[model samples]
Target: MAQLDISSSAISIPTLLIVNRYFDEVTSNIRERPMPWEGYQRASLITEQELLLLRNYSSRTGLKDQPTAEKYIDLFLILINKLSRMDALQYILVAFDDTIQKFPDTLVYLCQLEVKSEGSPFNTLKRCLGKDDDYLNLKAAKIITDLLNHASPKFVQTFDFTDLLLWLNRQLQSENPNVVDVSVQILQGLLKLRSFRPVFYGKAHLMNIFMGLIQASREGNPQMLYQLLFCLWLLSFEPIISDSLDKQYGVISQLVAIAKGASKEKLTRIVMATLKNLLVTAPGDNLAAMVAVKLLNFCDNLATRKWTDEDILDDIEFIRQELTERFQKLSTWDEYVSEVESGHLSWTPSHQSDAFWKMHASQLAADRGRLLNCLAHALNVPNQDPTVLAVAAHDIGQFVKYYPLGKKMVQDSGAKQKIMELLTHPNADVKYRALVALQVLMSHAWDQ
Candidate 1:
């Protein structure tokens, strides 16, 4: 894979500058096309002085005073509120985009001025998001991003981003690469606000967006991958969100895959960092899940690499150390529980260990044959793995041999019936395992 040089700053840029430089280069350069009739009509709304203000690409410091900057904002808002044509509206938004990027102080001025109408600056931007045009929505989203980046906490709390958030979520699935990139960028920026984190996290489409970005990472766009991972990294800081990152979503597996083949240092850094946070913030079940997915091996592999970044090295060592300590603490029964809960059965060493069955088989019967029931459920699942069926049957048979009430438990749990049905399994190993378990179930304890 070809490697890309990703700036460390790209992942952790300051909030005030997030929408300024990092995003503008990729987001603002929409393709040039001929102006529509509405473009000409909207152009007429701009007075010569206002047009001059739009043309001037100078810094905010170059403006004479505060009132001049306010006048400039007033003109931009007037044009934005009045423009209905997509082409003309996009052009005005583009100019405002340049204004915000070049002159951030304009945000402060615009924030202070409130027009008395439905078409206020914030409302106008929100309305623009409802348009069908991706580029138009992108510009509107960028303007919103800049405002949010610099907006006061009071402003943030008072404003409703419900619809805008929904629009951004929909944009994540856009065909335009720029649209997807900016959507993630805006989302990442939005999530930085501590109060806004839960709002975005609470969205019904949150997990779908995550899965989509994870799938997109496989396409090998480093920047897109980094932005998506950065959002996950941010989400990991909140324990609630971190705990809910279920193993079933294949999130940990996908991230491990990314770490294994990541060509950029920044990419490796963020992936490991995210996994490390998830390990600590999530519960023991999640920890067991990490081990279940072989994250430990990936950590060991990362530990051997000659990493130039100390943070990456520290993160790798921390994950390896934590995984090792946690794995070491897992008792045989706990290991067995983790395996059973993972819904995948195999002939791990515990399955063949005579001592394991002697020590833990009675425990399986303790919780009303809960573990045995899980094993049976695994057996009963449609089109289950042959190996899983074989091992599940073997475990149930071992349970019956070691525990006095194990036969009754298995019979009651329907495990014996499933095992009997599996005696005719297509796979030789499965049929054989099921036969052995069936014989054990049918025989008396005195016979042994």
Candidate 2:
């Protein structure tokens, strides 16, 4: 086994004294055991007296004043090193509780030691396993795993593990591209241990925390955005100990909102990647489709003339494909259209005759103007496709004639300017259709 030279390490003088004494006790116990395979076999056996002495030493050293305690810790470590050689399996198991209970602070110090020693503790533990007779190595592995699972509240409060994670997240948000890259590498290491996951996931506000991180990346930190997006993707896909409804809702909703409002190109790309991940991993149900549709709507709204022609075509095609896939399983056009249009499932269709529209006439009036503009655009398509023109004219005429408030809304809406513009279009068919929609509005206005 590779031995660590704690003699020259930063371990305090008092700790060294305790460790050396414990080592002497363990060495003596090995000598008294029955002979087996020369030196190695002798080192493998531990006696009851040695176990009691080690436990007493552990308790006393733990109770010593800080200065004395530091010196005693060094001694305890010496014993651990000697025991590592002897394969003192039962004694090591018995000693663990005392070591853990009596010297809680030691774990923190050891973690720092491990970090400074370039994973020396892990290496030593691994080597101890090489002697197949070393039950101590197996016990140590279990203890370490337990420590990770049972990370105490006091330990967390005193340490910066959580803060370190947050700091890394902040660094990722830095404008410096290199900082973001380094931050991601650091995060990868931190997340590798199973013990750390509960802490990461236990934050009741984790969803909000991640959302804030993503929002900060919208300016110029695309790399940070990507990292945050990937983190969220992992969290959503990772197997959690228990399903949490609130967390699921919070994470998905915040992600959808971010995808909709994010403006940076890289951030948008990351959001799209996250959305694709969700679509693939999430169940094929109404809730999932609703989220997918919301993202699609946001994408549709952001798809502008400023985008390259190819981009526009691609955007449209993507939306079309998703909608087609989502609607294909539905049994009816109305159900499918409702879902596509609003991204919500309608468990039951309304039987009332648009009564809500009548009750909120003024509110609907404001929206009615935009609907008319959409109607005008559909009617004025250059080709004047007969089917489209008929649908546009029919819907517009019906709305105007059936609803008394519709004519009043149009007159008050300042849609007259848009109507005039449409009337002067170059295509006679388009011009004629615009005139017809206007005449319908006018006839309704006169009746009113």
User: Lowest-scoring 10 consecutive residues by lDDT in candidate 2?
Assistant: 9-18
lDDT of 1 by residue, 1-448 (tens): 1211221112222223333343465344532333443334466855666545654523234455556656666766787776677766776676666656556677765655532342367876887888988777867876776666556666666667787777877898777666777678777776665556657777758667767777777676887788888887777766777777754454676788787778788889998888887887885647655755677887887788897888898988988888888889888778788878766566778998989989888988766777878898888888888998999999999999888878878889988888988978999999999999888877845564
Candidate 2 TM-score to native: 0.33
How does residue 338 of candidate 2 score in lDDT? 35
lDDT, candidate 1, residue 34? Answer: 39
Clashing pairs in model 1? none
Which 10-residue window of candidate 1 scores lowest in summed lDDT?
Answer: 1-10
Model 2 RMSD in Å is: 19.6
Writing each residue's lDDT as its tens digit, candidate 2 over 300-395 gives 665653533343345444654675576566543334233322222222222122453244323323444655554455444455445444434434
How many residue-pair clashes does candidate 1 contain? 0
Among these predicted structures, which one has the highest TM-score? 1
